[model samples]
Target: MVVFRSGLFFLAFLVIGGAWGQTMATVDRQALAELESLAAQHPSSKALVLAAQGHPVALVQGRATVGFIGLLNADTTPTAWRTWAQAHEAVFPGACRHGVASFRVDANHLDVLEALPMDRLELASRAVPNLDKARYGTRVDSVHAGLDLPTAFHGEGVLVGVLDWGFDYTHPMFYDTALTASRIRGVWDQYRTAGEAPDGFDYGAASLEPWEIQLMGSDTSNVYGYSTHGTHVAGIAAGGGAGVGLTGMAPASDLLLATLMVDEAAALDAFAWMQDVAEADNKRLVINNSWGLPQWGTPDGTSLSNVFIDGLSEDGVVFVSSNGNNGDSNFHIEQTFTTAGDTARSKVQFYPLSAHPHAWGQNLTLWGEPGEAFSANFMVTVGASTEVNQSPWFNTADGPFMLEAVHVAMEDTFVYDVVAEAAHPDNGRPFLQLRIHKGNTGLGVALQMTADQGTVHAWNHTHLSNDVGNWGQDFQAATSGWLQGTPAYGIQQPACGESVIAIGAYASEYLNSQGTEVGGSPAYFSSHGPTLDGRLKPNVSAPGVNVESSLSSFRDGAYAVTEEVEFDGMTYEFAKLSGTSMSSPAVAGIVALMLEANQNLSPSDVRDILEVTARQDQATGALPAEGEVEWGHGKVNAHQAVLAALNWVSWVGHPTLPDNPTGEDLMAQPNPAQERVLVSGNLSAQSTYRLVDTRGRVWQEGPASPVFRIDLQGMPPGVYVVMAWDPELQTSHTTRVVKTQ
Candidate 1:
């Protein structure tokens, strides 16, 4: 029997016999241990512990605990679970197509849920949003400059979806370039519960129309406190040149916004909702994720969230994410042992509680190669030499999960907990996680490790009260044998995923008194990457340094206002912010333009186009063909990328190509013709040919012979459609051809 405290009373649940016992036997031991640790650390909130079940906890209406539950398999629907929840008096929020669902339950009834067969149960992990753009640096201005040809793309007919918080829906930047109408197709506020949720989901308020968002004014406040992050990101991706005269990369694209719940699970829900909206509207969608959590998953991109993003990518939804902003922080260490009995040591530096009020302590995450093991312990010291207390050595091979805390008393008490694992199920790597609490302000912390064989990587991250941010801490070589940390492998989860187009940050160009000049360098804080499994990441780089964009007027605190605009009796503002978060949207907006040019392109196709068209200059210093750790494929080139997209459409067969009944293919020689194209196949003397551009305007129409030549001498360079109608068979065959300059 297990006893759980619920309010003033205690509830006892049986987990020893019958079907309940069998279910408990199959539960993930690591997850169970994590939950037990949380319960022990926070005994006062038994309801919170039960609801979280080792996951991060979010309180709904200040009472119920909400978390995610993964079903046993794809065959198992959430319907049965919903029924079970109802019998146990729990609230089932909704279900996602990936066999995951959200549930809210009281602490007392949580034990009943434990008896149900489940593949996994995850509590939401808190995530911080990454916070762009000099469009000319990426040549996006060239695309917006317009071409004399018919193929002019300003992200028209494409959907740009942003998943972040702090949006001022009434901002003029969300409207059309003429300010005559709103371009925001919809907005889903996951934290607000007073309105209708998006279709197919039971939580959050959904404003499908622009008028609804205008009435609400702003989303509900979150931990960030009426943030301006989401608004700024959106403005950079697709904001019209409303007030600042600085237009986003995709100014003519439609916008779909979602103020997330600051959790991994909620982000998944947002993706599903956005995709559904795009499908309903019959438009291609590109989602920009400017936030990430380093502690949330394995950095090799095999985590559930990474897999989910990959699945979405295959379904035609493109995902772009920020690599991270920890490039300047020395928070990562990699050590290898050539012989037995090799040891490594580093002194942990904790962030002060004064600057970070929610700073609980620091977390040291250590990972070793498969079939290899390592033992680690923490040492507390007074000043530089006096050892106050030393934690017990916890070896990863000893058990799947081990939890212990070290306590010491001098002038004040000092304490910290150690959580070790024999092998993480995700990648079969030996893992160790330590949560060092801020006990005595004067105590010093250090980590010591020993490994028999193989390499190990460790990262030190500052743990906040809500687990929302992954701000790094330094590892100093305080002692003779201690090693100093480096800034390599700083890319976080989601960004490390194979299918996600991770973006790095670079400084944009600006003119100084010394004449036209460019920053033309990687941002100091842009994270470096080559995922743990050794895969090149940060597919491309974009401008992220002090880029100007819209700001939320509803922000509660003081902020530096760079510019302001007055419209309809409301005052809106714009400001400059910097981070990888800003750069991801710049690429996403460019992706919108590519999609506008060719809607049939897949996620992989889009990635290839961006990489092949990326620009490399003196600032990049002759990067390798495979790309570099910091700059990826160098700076993004929007003009070349869109042109490549258009060219690709011609080869893959255009979407507008009509089916031919003649059982013969239409052919054009010198497809990318410089001056003329030879049209042949399935043609007759009585055939009439029409040459049209992308805008559906016929450039040439005339009678054709079996082997005819179409002159392209005066026509502008662009993709053109060629249709030939055979009057004898009363059939038409069409093909797309590219005209080069």
Candidate 2:
């Protein structure tokens, strides 16, 4: 039985005499009968029947059918569910939080899932990462120079985990500034199956030791091919320059690279793996996600992936993601029906052939206002007045879980599929999907729609045969249509996730060949957003345009190499790329610096500091107090953010310090002093004191008698730690102090 409550729908299935039945069913019987008829004639139609009946079914690896299922009761543990799944020959990858587990089974075994006691099932669509930054413009250079503190902050002791693909483990940029030691701690290649997987997981290969990664050299190519995306993103976040003079935002931070399998469940596993590694090493972790897709979740941030991210945020792990690169694409349209039976129409644009291997159609996703319903149909037109064919109307209310129809017009045949839900279980909005196959027909395609009494929002994306990627296409005002699309609400998930910091892109200021100042405005392609739920996304913007970073030497694809260097008898290359994918890592590197300043900072604390210290200028225009769609809180100010982080630590008291004082609490007078600092506190006699920078490099150490003076002359300004130890009492006390130039 499926019941609608508080705008959301819940499913409760009952079995009668070894057959599945619904009580108080919401599915339209006529639509179901039509779907059944189609299934009998087409092998692909069987998957549609499963979908229309409220069972999530998806094609995995172009062969098997897979989905995620939620256990019915608290008594049914994930362990027991996995056991049952294994007995039925179903592959249970792993269990997720909130009692949900993912399964991969043959198409023939898909029906067996119906017999299990489950509360909800969903299609686990693979996420397409936003692919497509830099230094001085964000004021990171000022922080690196220690302009007004005791020691420079280079994200030392911080772990930067990048979840991306196409990593060259042997890239020279992964080495330290001296080119002697590698900064990468580990690499989890989820596509590799020969070697041992990471502990606590059953798939993929893990390269933990540095020698092991070097032995592998690079990850095997996947669907995206032997790409350079991951290496480039990681370079922007933490590359050590390798004598290339292109320093990343946090050059001293360690790296953990995961070449994801492109699915949400696999992504969750990567996060868990990185967290475990961070915990074991006792270092703060920051994960950079430069990829996302709308199909992974509702734009409102209620998907399982979002829930998992929120949980991780509470555990002190920070997440940063790209807002996407569709700011200039007219891929969205919205319509409101004040009275009953209001209608709207628009032409659907399809990408040119070979844009992608699976680019054979366009997908239109519709979301209606709560408690309201809408109906949609597809029309094939010849020229301006002739209608070649029109498919049946599928209403959101009482529609089949899925419906597929065929229309023949002379020598052309058109096939369209519809997936509808009266009320979404997550946000309670009426959701519908229309996938129209281009079918080698050169004719025109358009969408006709009507709503009974509410507003509906629709987004058009290139529909790939593999059901991955979310590249958008335009919707134009056709001969008989008045509605056209706009480039708004373009932020993708998990950037839309409530706790994740979504970053936008802006071109760093530079001088043109004419000697005129240019740039410093939002990148035309940076995704815009005040998410569907009216929450400001792109928490802030960063430098992303024409940003120079490292390229993978193992990449098979041709690239425009900007510079080349010979390191250790091998030539490495660098190149410039642009997209929100670039801007996201710039912010992730800044977050690492903030964490270095105060290891106790939460994800929210990091976001607040970044926003409060963000800079607004002519490029961003005059921004409101709450931020805007394109620029968010304005451009990131790394110098101010680091200062604020230090202040935040002071206000809350350093987490590493002892709560009670034992006449050993250390304090420094005239902190941020230019010439000298007088160290005095509840110190014991014969105590020895050492002044060390954030990087653990000791500046001065000597025997003390409760009070001493340390000269700050010739020392770079930044944050530093002062520690006092009383050997007689076997006690030590530590506190932080700042120095100024």
Q: What is the TM-score of each candidate against the true structure?
A: 0.80, 0.78
Candidate with top lDDT is: 1
TM-score of 1: 0.80
Residue-wise C-alpha lDDT for candidate 1, range 1-741, written one tens digit per residue: 454543322333222122232222111333444455555565455355444422545445444444553444444566665565556645545445555555544433456555654665544455787752488798888788855324667899999999998988889999898888989999998878689988766667898877788898888886567989999999999999775687998999999999877567778888888999898989999999899876767889866667667878888999999999998888988889877778788888888777765677888888899889998877777786356766667787874543434355454544455555566656778887777775546878888888988888888998766445567888888867788998888889789999999999999976677877768788989998888888888899999999999988898866688888887788888988999989999999999999998898999889877876677888887676567889997899888788768756432453454543343256666544569988876777899988887656789999876788899999877667778888887888775566666
Alpha carbon lDDT of each predicted model: 0.76, 0.75
- Stretches off by above 4 angstroms in model 1 are 1-55, 59-62, 69-71, 78-88, 91-93, 100-108, 147-150, 381-389, 409-412, 441-443, 479-481, 513-515, 649-741
Task: Kindly report which residue stretches of model 2 are placed more than 4 angstroms away from their true locations once superposed.
Answer: 1-73, 77-89, 98-108, 115-118, 354-357, 382-389, 409-411, 440-443, 479-481, 511-517, 649-741
Q: Which window of ten consecutive residues has the lowest lDDT sum in model 1?
A: 18-27
Clashes of 2: 11
lDDT of 1 at 74: 42
